[model samples]
Target: MTHTIRNLSTLVELRSNEVEKLQSEVAAKESLRERHQKTLDKLTHLYESSGASGRLPMALALNCGDYKQGVMAMAAHQKVNLSMHEADMAVSQRALTAAYVKREVLGQVLEKHQHAAVTAQRSQERKQHDELATQLWYRGHK
Candidate 1:
């Protein structure tokens, strides 16, 4: 019985550790998600303000004033688009990482639970075996 109790305690400890690890992973992922979202927003805003479209009145005015200025604006817009694409890729990567972490944590917890169940079953079987042996021994003495 004492051994069984010890085994139960160990199982509880493992469960606690798993929970803590999962919580930490969740927090890290959430932080990464927020940072990625902020980066994406900044890139989108930059792209919008670059005036890539020739139809924009401001771009047309710049084209009238200086062909060089219109070209620069277009170049800036292209740079902004590239930045947006990079940010999008980063967001996708971060999201996938978070998902993988979540799955891994879940798997670990499940494994621990399975182990605990097996231990408990073994402990019960041992107790029953011991009880049966004692009963048989007492009957034989009588």
Candidate 2:
């Protein structure tokens, strides 16, 4: 039983580590999304502030249009990527929650086993002491 408890403890430790790794991955994905959003915002701001002001050379107009189109495409792609990351994070969160619950249950079982062992030991000690006291009483009466 002790061996089983030890193994379970080790499993719990491993699961905790896995949860940490998943959390870090989620953080990284969130950071990526933030950066992408900032890039999109800057592109939109720049285009709005400059591209709408006046007519330019044909070449310059075409270049500006291409730039706007490219930024829009990148924004779309980033939106999809962000959703994927959010989905992944949600899945990881669920897995982490499950792992924590399992670990908690195992810890409770281990505590109960320890408590029972202590109770049994105390009972045995009490029985031995009673027997010794009874023997002493009989010897004195004799």
Deviation from truth (RMSD, Å), model 1? 8.1
Worst 10 residues of 1 by lDDT: 63-72
Clash count in backbone of candidate 1: 0
The model with the greatest lDDT is 2
lDDT of 2: 0.75
TM-score of 1: 0.45
Clashes of each: 0, 0
TM values, all candidates: 0.45, 0.76
**Alpha-carbon shift of residue 129 in model 1 (angstroms):** 0.8
Return the lDDT, model 2, position 24: 80
How does each model score on lDDT? 0.65, 0.75
Name the regions of candidate 2 deviating beyond 4 angstroms. Answer: 1-11, 17-50
State the lDDT of candidate 1 residue by residue for 1-142, as single tens digits. Answer: 4565466557556656655665676567657656655655665565556654456698686654465455446656666655675676567566656655655665566567668878989999999999999999999999
Q: Candidate 2 versus the native: TM-score?
A: 0.76
Candidate 1 error regions (>4 Å): 1-79
